[model samples]
Target chain A: MKAKHQRLVLALFALAGVAGAGVLAASALRDEAAYFRTPVEIRDGKASVGEPMRLGGMVAANSIRRQSDGLTINFVATDGKASVPVEFKGIVPDLFAEESGMVADGRLRGDGTFVADRILAKHDERYMPPQMGEMPKNMKAPATT
Target chain B: MHAYANPTRFLAIAKPLTPWLLGVGLLLLLVGGWAGLTQVPGDYKQGETARILYVHVPAAWLGMGGWTALAVAGLVQLVWRHPLSGIAARAIAVPGMLFTALCLATGSIWGRPTWGTWWEWDGRMTSMLVLLFLYAGFIALTNGDEGQRQGGALSRGAAIYAIVGAINIPIINRSVVWWNSLHQGPSITLRGSSIDGALLWPLGLTLLGFSLLFGAMVLMRMRRIIADNRVAARLRRLADDEGI
Candidate 1:
């Protein structure tokens, strides 16, 4: 075949392959795009249940419970405004603890429970979380004693 | 683009720019590394591990950016059949693959202490791995010994591969958001960065430094390839004169 004709044929084949792969990828991403939401959003009915999503908040203090199976655990994640109960069947991340920020990826059940398949703990670039007990001087009340 | 297609003109610009870029890049990289290691405070949760972000983010940016550059060059080669465009794409592959590998290694190291595992088959990690494999395939196909086969057909074939492989670049970028990934969501956005201002400064510097380094490497490689091609053509002409 002439070189020009051969080049045209090759170009056409390449374009067709790219188009086909793009279509496949777009369809795959549609089901995979999981949006993130906080417990407050879940409490306010702003987040949809039964869809894959991420829940981000702090682990509520004294709310973690482990079952006899050892692998199953339950905890409550709170954002100071609201909270969501989370259930998981695997080992929690080493850094997961009460009052620490975390995110869980899974589907929310109709019963208002989040069943997480995976959990990720978030860390801030500071030596300590802003001293939780210290109220700023601006927010302190005038002496009433 | 055609205005700079002439090799002599391109070299005139690139020759002086290469050393300046390399010097600035090395200086900024040292400063950025110093700030990340000493000046930035340790994380409340992650402690010193957070500093890895300084190196990791820049590497990841270049990994994706390099492929984008390759795709653009490939597009030019295909549409205009411009001679230098293939050289640009060829120059990009080696360093681009190196950065992708670096990103993956740093991410794994960071993940070990933070996530309690060295690797996870999550969307973001998996897609980046695929990008690295695509780079390897392109390098092998383009640079492999083809004894006496002309560069035209091979370069056109490689350009097609480069363009096709570009489909992975976006997927790597969006993987964390598009799937339930262990990797965190993007910390930097057009409006602002989620990272603290102090840390962001070092990260921005490192990203600029790495990009400059990438540019310098590509220019250097293209220059060497051009020189090599000239010598080979001269040898071929000499052989023809000998009537063998």
Candidate 2:
């Protein structure tokens, strides 16, 4: 009987674990699932609102703007196929983060600015770039923050 | 077959490596965490939230890695009948479930700023969830019976389930690819690497740490299990001899 009870406890724990996993999976999909889409995807009514998501593309070269609050910045992120204007209310990411495979998070407000909460940049494809530039004596990565 | 089943011999070899394994596991995990947390640059986009990747990605990797290891361990136990394999299998489950859960949780956290929803039935997520269920199922099946007859056999079940789950893991991972779906394509290296240096280095370090940690923890737990079994058998024998 005690052993049977032990089995019950293990099963309950397993169930609880599954429940926990399910909860997390659901939430992840809700929050992170957006950035997976293409420009056509968001335009094709595939984007979901009322939850967070990642939006990735090139920041259209000259479309960036800083709002009056000084923290809110707006820009257009595009896949070259289609473009989505993005608005972010935080410190700007690395300068190189733009015009490359830049990622943004937030939402498309009614006014059409994507209110971004986060930004990510992808690495370059060249595995071994020529370390051509002379290094400064105390060089560090340039900061845009 | 019984040659390796001798717990005494197994203990002789295992005891020496225990501390070393623990030490290495600790060292790697600590260093990995620091590298992931401090050295890695913040996401140009996500800000501080991207820090979760150090934990989340490694957890996801380990979750998958644990089950894969279990599947193999299960096979060994079933075929080789290594008395320790069952212990190994059982040991793997706890961390397997833990890492899988971590993966799911971290993925959700990453989603909030990206997906705009807390949850979705994405293919990769669903399959990983299924893996979690499989881990739970394995634990339940093994832990169900008491006497040697009913469900006493776990390695056999575990091996079978692990293989089955192993076969399914890919299916789950690729389900979105085969079919046009809402799920995101692979975010990591599958498509020539998407993660930046700020993220990848930490992820790589943490993954190494977690793998080492899994090795150490599984070994420690398996040794303890084997020792307990000996104690149990001894107690039973004494009870029978004394007619208690």
Which numbered prediction scores highest in TM-score against the true structure? 1
* Model 2: fnat (fraction of native contacts): 0.00
lDDT tens digits, residue span B1-244, model 2: 5665666776787788777777776777788788767775666544566677778777877888788787766666555555556677777888789889988888877766544445556566777888889889988877634522221236445556665566545555555555323334555543455564445665666777777777777778777666666677888889999999
DockQ of 1: 0.17
The top-ranked prediction according to DockQ is 1
How do the residues A112-138 of candidate 1 rate in per-residue lDDT, one tens digit apiece? 999999887754323322232234636
Candidate 1 TM-score over all chains jointly: 0.76
TM-score of 2: 0.62
Candidate maximizing lDDT:
1
TM-score of chain B of each: 0.95, 0.85
lDDT of 2 by residue, A1-145 (tens): 5754664465446545655665566455553443345555677766766456656677777787888999888778887788888877776534334565665657666654567776654433211111311235266433211
